[model samples]
Target chain A: MSSSATINRSSAFSSPRVGQRNWEYATLYIFLAPFAVLTALFGIWPIAESIRVAFTDSYTALSDSPVYVGLDNFRAVLAEPAFHSSLWRTLVYTFLSVILNVSMAIGLAILLAHPRLSRGRTFFKLAIFLPVITPDVASFIVWKWMFNQNFGVVNQALLGLGLPPFAGVTQPGSAFVTLVLVEAWHHVGLYTLIFLTNLQLLDKSLDESAQIDGADRWQRFIHVTLPQLRPAITINTVYALIEFLKTFTVIFVITKGGPNFSTNFVSYYAYSKFNSAQYGEATAIATILFVIVFAVVAASYWYMEKGDQR
Target chain B: MSDGAVTDQARRSAVRATLESTVLYTVATAIALMFVYPFYWMLVSAFRSQEAILSAPLRLIPEHLDLTAFQTIASIGGTPLSSFAFNSVVITVLATAIGVCATGLGAYALYRNPRLPLFTSVRYSFLLTIMYPHMLLVIPLYFVSYKLNLLGSTLGIILVMSLVPLIFFIFVQFFRSVPQEMIEAARIDGASEWQILTLIIVPIAKPVILTATLVAFLLNWKQWFPVMVLSTGPETYTLPVALISLNTEYGINFQATMALSTLTVVPVVIVFVLTQQRVMGSFMAGAVKG
Candidate 1:
């Protein structure tokens, strides 16, 4: 509240702020200089350079200068068989993971919001949320152990149920499922927390009115609940989609996109190019990814706000 | 009677819910086991003999635990754990301090006038930066870092690694929640912009500032790409990079990997236990209330 008083005081005396001219801008400039320099020199430079690198024949062992190959990099990327396979796989992983993560999070948010579920409830959230904070490498190691083909907990539980022992990591499709499941499990906690928080902000009277109308648990959730949670759904979906697209460390830990390039995404492909010493081609891949990601984020924000405005 | 049938269906629904409650508890425990087991396994595996690791992979129960991995790590690396930890501490501390300050100032500037040049554009860019893949930025950014002679230096890693676009965006959103009258009072005091930012603004944001610090630290501590790119030697490498190297060099030994993994997660667990509320506060503010 004191901040309000201070803010009012400052805007009242706003003019002549910062010593009145370029000569007096030194203090602010000095404070801001470190960030601006670092971002410009490294952050923006790489992004710009990557675009330049994408338009040339930059993939060969013999070429140092990356001969002007105009659109060839894009053409080559599109033509590569693995590129299409990887792209499709990436899309599928992102789609399935986001849908599962967001939906379960929403469901859990509703369940956990029950007033009866109050006592000792914080423990439940912390239990689920622990994985979200676990470092990717460590969490990856844990999941790998759980998905162990023979002796891991998952298989152990399955066998304990008198079911057939599931073979693991030996097939591409099966591994993809395990990977997605692990990713979804790791992330659901964050969304649950997100959605649950949003749910708490809504009008209690609305839920009460529905109850007065003789609504039950499932009805309250579906009608009175779900529609009110759309804003959260939008945020959660955007976050999950971006995160799923950028997933590398987990996959790197589990299968290294293995049994072939079954789980590989564009980011990892870019990493592979760097390791392969095709710097230009690597930069090209990254540039394309940046463009794609940038476009998605921009369009989503534009549309989301437009929707909100209406 | 139709009424009897309706009652029967309701009974069936109640039974189904009881079954679901059982399922929920089971799923919850199973997830907890998955989440918590690695740390326990790490403790056991890190202590057990190498031969034990290979021969008894299915042994959920540890037969015998020893500190051979710990001893080895201690002897050759001569404080690999501590040094890696120390490096992480230094990097995280500086980055967080610098990050929060920038965020506070930027948020204040935007919130005060809302007419700041490119304010909306800045807001949009920060949002976009959340999706910005730093992994993809690794290669190209490495070249720039190399040119700047920042490669292999802690200073370089800290500076370049401090891009907090999301942090900035989140704070701007956070600042919007700060009542406008506070800014007005600060303005009325005839305080300089910096004075208003430092004295009046930051104190109000302490809770979220702490939350943001923890989040940023967790993110940076686990970050391997920039540190991996910059640090050429063991001494300079941060914990995550060192852990990765340990995994490969140790031949994917699960016990050792778990041990190192356990080490990486200790700070988060400790911080979560200590300040979970501050951390959860961020969620509370943004989420819609039920």
Candidate 2:
């Protein structure tokens, strides 16, 4: 319905008018004025100013006039061991999180979409998706409390089972794993729903033919079904990657980049810098992250376009 | 082959199928539990006394329904819970309301004047902003706010949060599906553009409006980074900020924090449950189109 509507709308829009009216032009700007002004001020202007601030000696947030110091902040950030570790940790976190979230989503989508599994599909979906809609801070705080070293229910449960208590976010080694788990728990539902929607829309004849050809379920899935799900795969992967890269609130609430800074990703690192009144370095770090994210988005977009052409 | 052999094979296959389904259900249930158990614990802990919450041999259910946690947070000296709730409501309502109007009007303009070069560029520019990391924009926005004297002001946060690109795109998508003929017919009958929009477009686009409004409200309500950065004092704190401050100040007052978390999450969960279909539909639309 929407696609056909889009087609018709585009065609009608392309039809040449005799002449564009003055009032139409006037109405266009008037209608657009609020969005335009807000976007310019809050959207575009900030990005432009951020890039500009990266090169200046604006140490304080209240600096009225900052002197130009081209590349100094960038140099300092690149040279700092803390920034390097944060960047490296961020990359690792993004990689792990994307893998976990995308795989979990695909797995759950396949399970829920299975023809034999009819009962409780809605129950399973609602359960998984509830966390996605829950307020982030509230949920993370709950997770943090649950993972408390001494009194946390998680440790208590383990001890009750006559097993050694697992160190959740209290130790550096397990903190990253715990963070990824919490992040994946909070996010996987959305990606799962996306994949599930695509799965339902898929043509089932291919799978049937593959089955007739004596293909096992795994063979059918990998050779036939998985190939058809490329678009959803790309979308979920990119979205999850971007989301984990900018992960802040969870770390802020749960770990505070503590237990030896194990979860101090780039976003939190930059935020900490900003909090302590180091505007130049913070924005520079932010600028670097922005460039990296932009490159990833552009690359995936190009990949999708190329795939579409084929 | 004998008929008995065939019957035996059929019975074996049926049993195998049932076993597979059982395994599938068990795995699905466990996964679902992992996602939902924390929320359950939060609710349970909220109703338990502080001692029970911290006690060993963890109880999954509260012994009694305790109101002390709620009372404690409510009566906490300096910046009561009501103030935080008030800030959240005011910010979310103002931002979502203005955001829907601005996005609807702008999307209508873009939809109608798709041929105009300026509008085309403007549309692309709005889309382009999505590629930038929010932190990049926000880091500099802190400076922008400071310079404009909006650093600690709720109005500043509302204005910043209102200009959502995703909402704009959703509006544009929905507006494109509205029959252009209705709009044109109204225009031909001497209805002004504003009249055509409010009377013709708005009524027809109620579902989209609701979806956009709900999404905008949720986004603004859960907003933490911007509010945290902008607000200088506790007076301007939203629920999320206030909740965090409570944690930091009290230092593991389990009952109170859980109570606050419950208070924060219950309304959102209720709203989501009531409008689950619409919310899910909007997300699917956004995801597929995006």
Candidate 3:
């Protein structure tokens, strides 16, 4: 019904006369003025300004005048060993975090899809989804406390189990690992809900036929259920990849790029540069990250479109 | 003999079903508990004394009712907690209301008048903003804010955050579902396009409005990064910023920090409790339907 309305509307729009078009366009401009103005100021213009700033030595505090430094800022950012390692660390963090979080979401979605679990569905859903909605700073604060070396419940639990307490956030390696875990915990619920909704809406007849053909549950899942879940997988993977790539608050609150900059990702690196008032350098790093994210999202979207064609 | 064997196999499958269900329930419960325990601990620890919090043996239950943490948070560094709370409430409410109005009206316009070259171009620009990485824009936004003299003001924050493409996209999705007949009737009744939107369309799209409002509210309430970069001092800080600054100012006071954290979290949880079902359902419905 809606699709047909859309078609009819498009036909009407395409056939509208030129003389009357001005009046219609005028009305639309009036309606769109607010969004257009805001987007220009905050979104488009700033993006344009970022590109301009990326090539110049611009510092807000140091000087109002920006010197055209050509590719010096980009060259400096690329040459820094810190930049390379942070980029690598960010990739590793995103990779591990996406895998863990997406798998956990799928696992939980499968469990929640159980017919027998319907009675307690809302309880579990809200319990898991609560973290996704909570304020980032507040949630990070709690988790930071949870990872406290001396009094954190995690270390306490380890001690109770008769193993030595790990310096959770004080060390570089464990701190990075801890960050990945906390991030996954904070975000997995959203993907779980996404996958869960997709799962519940699945056409059950395909799986039923598979079962009737003497396929075991695992076999049916592998052959029928998994293939049908391509759309959800695409959505989850794209979203998770983008999210992990832009991770900031958890690191900001807990590690501050921590013991030897082990947990420093590109986002935090850009932020730290901004903290030092190196606007050109900061925007350069940000531009690099933006291109990376854009490429990943575009690639995934293309892959999904191809899958649909298949 | 074949019939008997079939019955035995059916019984065996039933047992297996029950076993799998039990395992599923147990795992689900454990995971929920694991996710929820830290929040539970945050609540319990807020009322605990500092020593009780730091003691070797962890106490799941509060040993005593202590108000020191709450007291400290209320009067920390001569800034009243109410001031920060008031700032957050004002910022969040204004941002949500303004954001919904802007996006809702704009989306309705786009939906009602499609394929107009100019509007289509503008619509695509908004959509482009939706996918563009915001990190790159932060530096330039700061520069823009500095030039416009909007750096330290709540209204500035509201303006910057409210015109976001996410809300616009959500509104566009919902507005697409609005039936055309209703608008045509309004038009024939001598109503203007604005009247059609305000009088006919908005009343029918209450759920979308609510969903957008809730999401914008959540996003603003939890906003800390922009506040950190844009706002200058304690006077302009929101609740989340205030809590972090308090954490920094008063280190080793976990009790007070937790108390402040709980206080910072209370309104969001209250909002969530009131509208969790509608909000979650709307989000899932929107994503799935799209």
Which candidate gets the maximum lDDT versus the true structure? 2
Model 1, span A107-199: residue lDDT tens:
778666756555546777777777777677667776776677643656776777899876566678778888888887778888898888788
Looking at candidate 2, what TM-score does chain B attain?
0.89
For residues B29-121, what per-residue lDDT tens digits would candidate 1 score against the true structure? 565566566566655666666567556554666676666566555422454577887888898788777776666565555566544445555
Task: Write the residue-wise lDDT of candidate 3 on A1-310 in tens digits.
Answer: 4445435544666553442346556887788778777877888777777778888885533357767888989999999999999999999999998889888888889888889887788888988888888887988898899888765899898888999887888999999988988988899988888898789778899998888899998998889988777778788888889889988888888889988999889999998998887888988898898889889978987998898798
DockQ for all candidate structures vs. native: 0.36, 0.51, 0.48
Of candidates 2 and 1, the better by TM-score: 2
lDDT tens per residue, model 2, A152-267: 88888888799998799879978888899889999999999999988987888988899999999899889998998998999999888888888888988888898898988898
DockQ of 2: 0.51
Task: List per-model TM-scores for chain B.
Answer: 0.80, 0.89, 0.88
The first chain of model 3 has a TM-score of: 0.91
Ranking by lDDT: 2, 3, 1
Worst lDDT 10-window in candidate 3 chain B: B281-290
lDDT of 2: 0.83
CA RMSD, predictions in order: 5.4, 5.0, 4.6
TM-scores of chain A across the candidates, in order, are 0.87, 0.91, 0.91
Question: Fnat of candidate 1, please?
Answer: 0.34
Model 2: interface root-mean-square deviation in Å: 5.1
